[model samples]
Target: MKILIAEYAGFCFGVKRAIETAYYEIEKNSGRKIYMLGEIIHNPQVISDLSKKGVNIIEEEELDKLTEGDKLIIRSHGVSKKLYDFLAKKGIEVIDVTCPFVKKVQDIVYEHYHKGYSIIIVGDRNHPEVRGVNGWCDDTAYVVNSIEEAHKLPKLEKACAVAQTTLIGRYWEDILEVIKLKVKDLVFFNTICDATQKRQGSAEQLSKKVDVMFVIGGKHSSNTQKLKKICEKNCKNTFHIEDAKELTLEMVKDREIIGITAGASTPDYVIEEVIKKIRFLKGEKEEE
Candidate 1:
């Protein structure tokens, strides 16, 4: 069996920066308590490594428990404006590691919202990044993830649209086109991250050439799920796995070629392990 790994797999610039920043802050203030609002990134392995290093992951409800001098790291997914304000009001030292691409979407929403333009975000509403962007617009922005949702929106006199940084490019275009038809005066910004586009594009192309495809990343990761969906469209045998341990021999037994792609937050070691497991499985079958 042949294994084809994607050219654009593993950590992206933003995720890399966030992880590095977390480590730097942890080391810089060894005695102070450090907490992250959520997982610094979506990968379990990375989060586990950080937790072993004394970093604590706290939920939103735990915010009030924090006191002055406590350091809170804003995750790469960013947070709502209200959350930021609340953290400041509580006097917790905030180390913002929000991805620049996500920050750009927030800034754009804030600017257009204040200028009397209705904000429309083309992505999953429940996603942390989308929720953060919505917060900047006072939770008034319309979050649409599909062409169906876009069509349901009421006609607007003025509006500005921005996509979640990890949204698939084709899905964004499809939703945007529907929004354009509904809004009289629309300003659209393609806020999808460049890395995301390349990753999705590469996954799609690779899936077409392989008999089975494995998309590796955290199950909760939006981008990783998007990659799985993209690959599924081209290769029906696509499987989404968080790690190599989830792989079964039945998934690989008859496939002549396998393609592997990972999300931005996936670590190199996880990808390597998955590849190794597949090779071992193939070798054992050959010996049989």
Candidate 2:
């Protein structure tokens, strides 16, 4: 048996910057209390690791529970203008970690919305990042995750488009192509993260060359889910898991070559553990 890992796996630059910023503040503040606006990233393990370090996470429902002077840290997904203003009015010290790539999407959505172009967001509607993007344009933009959903959309003023930062680049392009043909004066921007494009492209190539595909990352990680989607499209025997416990001999049973890829939020350590598990499984099969 063999294991092949994608060349581009694990944390991208944005996630790394956010995690570093939060960890640095945690160590520097010592006794001070800090609260994240949301899950720092969608990775459950990373959030658990930070929680043990005394970082408190708060969502919209928890806003009223905040006390004066408690520090507020924005997550990398970015937030709506209303949320930012609301936090500002609370007089809390804000530590913003919104990814620059995501921030650009927010601006694009807000600007086009105010300009009166009906907006179309091409990504998962329920995703916090997409929700945040929509929050800026509320009544003007419609969120559609796929062509099927887009088909139900009503014709609006000339449409302007933006995508969730983690959207697969090709998918975004295809959706944009559809919108262009649907709207008379359509305008679109490719706000998908370059890192996501590179990662998916690499994963697709790796998947075609391997027998079993192991996609590693947290279940809630959007980018990680996308990685699994890409891998499974090329390799039917793809498995998505966060840690080594989920991997077993049965999953790798008849495969001589295995490919491994991880979501953007996944750490290098997680991928290493998966690799180690595959090697152990291979050894067990050889012994049998």
Candidate 3:
């Protein structure tokens, strides 16, 4: 059996920075209660490790119960302007670890919305990143995730658009084309993360050459799910698993070639474990 692992799999720059920031805060504020507004990143293994180290994940509804002296770490997905303001008003110390790429999109929406241009976000409506961007525009932005949604958008005189950092490039272009026809004036920024583009591109290419493909990441991770979807279109035997424990012999039996890729939030160790398991199942010696 031959195995091909993606050259760009696992943590990207932003996720690495965010995870490091969380650890730094934990070390610097010893004995203080540290709470993350949500999962520092999308990976379950990473979150579990952090929890064991005393980092707690707090939900939106739990915000009101927090008081002064509690440290809040903002997830990489960023938060809405309202959430930021509310946190400030509550007197909680906030450590913003929002990814720089996501911050750029928030700034763009804020600047253009104030200038009288309608804001259009090309991505999932419910995604935290898109919700954060919409918050800057006072929740007035139109969230379009499909060609059908873009076509249904009312004609506008002037509009400015940005994409969720993890959006697929082709889908973004498809939606943008329809919006261009409907709007008299349109300004669109392709905010999809560069790493995401490269990872998805590599996954698509590898899927075409492999008998089976594995996309490893958190089940709730948007980018991971996108990778799985892209791979499935090319390779019928695509599987999305969170870790090596989910691997089964039946899935790999008789497969001549296999490909593996992971989401931005996945850690190197988790990817290594999955690769090691695959090698073991195939009766191949592990790499040094």
Candidate 4:
């Protein structure tokens, strides 16, 4: 049996920055109460590990519980302007770890909305990143994730559109074409992260050459789900799993070639563990 891995597997720069910053803050301020706005990234294992080390996860509703001098670390997904202002008013120390790409989308939405342009976001409406981006425009942006959703939009004279950072590339193109027809004057920004495009491209290429494909990441991660969907189209035997413990002997027994790809939030150690487990299942030695 042979194992092949995607060239761009594991955490992207944004996730790395967020996790590293979170750990640093935790250690640097050992006595102060630390709270994360949400899961630092979407990975449960990463969240759990940090929680064990003393970082507390809280939602928007729980902000009132915080007092002055408390440290609140914003996740990579970011928060709305309203939340930031509220924290500032409460005198809480805010550590913003929002991805630079996500911050760019918020800036574009804020700038375009003030110029009297109707804002539209192409992404999952419920995603935290999309929600935070909408907040910049006061939550009035039209959010759509599919071509059908785009068609359902009312005709507009002028509008500006931006995409969620982790959205699939082909979905963005398909939806953008439909959006162009619905608006007379349209301004669009391709806000999808460059790393996302590379990861999807590599997964697609690797899936085509292997018998079975494994996509690793948190189950709730949007980027991981997109990777699974992309790989599934090319290889029907694709599996989406969080870690090596989810792998079964039956899944690999008859497979001659296996391809592995992970979401941007996945850590390198998790990927290495999966590879090691697969090797063990094949009766290979540690050196091999």
Judging by lDDT against the true structure, name the best candidate: 4
Q: So what's the TM-score on candidate 3?
A: 0.97
Q: What is residue 108's positional error in candidate 1, in angstroms?
A: 0.5
TM-score of each: 0.96, 0.94, 0.97, 0.98
How much lDDT does each candidate structure score?
0.93, 0.86, 0.93, 0.94
* Candidate 4, 1-288: lDDT as tens digits: 989999998899999999999999989999777999888799999999999989999999989999999999999998899888999999999999999999999999999999999999999999999999999999999999999999999999999999999999999999999999999999999999999999999999999999999999999999999999999999999999999999888888889999999999999999999999899888784634
User: Candidate 3 lDDT, tens digit per residue, 218-246?
Assistant: 99999999999999999999999999999
Q: What root-mean-square deviation over C-alphas does model 1 reach?
A: 2.0
Instruction: List the candidates ranked by lDDT, beginning with the highest.
Output: 4, 1, 3, 2
Please identify which of the two predictions, 2 or 4, would achieve the higher TM-score against the true structure: 4
lDDT of 3: 0.93
Model 1, 1-288: lDDT tens digits are: 789998899899999999999999989989778999988899998999899889999999889899987999999999999998998898999999999999999999999999999999999999889988999989999999898899899999999999999999988888988999999999999999999999999999999999999999999999999999999999999999999999988999999899999999998889988988898788743321
Off by over 4 Å in 2: 284-288
TM-score-wise, the better of 2 and 3 is 3
lDDT score, candidate 2: 0.86
